[model samples]
Target: MERSINVLALMKDGERFIFLYDEQSTPQLLQTLGRYAADPEMSFSWYDAAVLSQKVRRLKESQERTTPDVRRSA
Candidate 1:
């Protein structure tokens, strides 16, 4: 199935950026957008939703790698 996502807003100042997506979009699309928002390189550069989503995913993965894993063994 082909789904369409609308980009409500894409604002950036200096190194910071904010992306707003339409509420009608699917959760999968939203998840993808979140991924791109975390990228250091692509975070600031995205032409479309698809590309942005890719960047967001990469950014999220990078963040996960740096995050400390907490587990307790009993």
Candidate 2:
């Protein structure tokens, strides 16, 4: 079993924003995006967070649809 690391990046107005996370860390990543959006000094905006969050959710959903569930009954 290998691990998958998801990398998301955005470059705008000469600035680059990058995030690395696994499926489990997505919520934390979303929170971090919110924090960035709230900071007045950064160029990151709520729209950016919303867009990225949608992307993250879609990726997760696609993965879920492809993977199979295995269970044992005793």
Candidate 3:
């Protein structure tokens, strides 16, 4: 069975954005999107949830603030 394409939201450097295309697309998909990636500055690449998760992790790690402690005040 072929995996379907699903648009997903991805965050980079605290910025949120949407990414198009399915993460499980075959090599043929790469060939199809090659034109979009031809530019040196702007290019589209396939990024799965795992990859995106890592990026989010890194962003969280790089932060210089302490995690907020949720507590009830008397």
Candidate 4:
């Protein structure tokens, strides 16, 4: 299966963060690392992929909650 970059950061708050991008574009981001790494004189390094998938499945039986049936009388 083709893989997409999905970096999730689970924060203290009940919120999920997802960073999706291409591996080839990482060199641009390395500039923020530091001057030593930012200098064009330095070479950039590449890393392998480490991926994880989140799965959701509902197994237990549950009643379907719906709005109460409405009736009108004239």
For lDDT, the strongest prediction is: 2
Against the true structure, what is each candidate's TM-score? 0.38, 0.91, 0.26, 0.24
TM-score of 4: 0.24
lDDT of 4 by residue, 1-74 (tens): 34345233322245443334444444432333334334565342121011111210011111112323235321
lDDT of 2 by residue, 40-68 (tens): 99999999998999999999999988766
Ranked by TM-score from best down, the candidates are: 2, 1, 3, 4
Candidate 2 stretches with Cα past 4 Å from truth are 72-74
Q: What would the per-residue lDDT of candidate 1 be over residues 1-74, giving only the tens digit for each residue?
A: 23333443455564444454433444666665656745766754435556666655565577558656655322
Regions more than 4 Å wrong, model 1:
1-17, 20-47, 72-74
The lDDT values for all models are 0.53, 0.90, 0.46, 0.30
Question: Which tens-of-lDDT digit does each residue in 1-74 have in candidate 3?
Answer: 34445444645566565645544443334344444345455434344344544544454454414434335321
Q: What value of lDDT does candidate 4 attain over all alpha carbons?
A: 0.30
Global CA lDDT of candidate 3, please?
0.46
Better-scoring candidate (TM-score), 1 or 4: 1
Worst 10 residues of 1 by lDDT: 1-10
Total clashes for model 4? 0
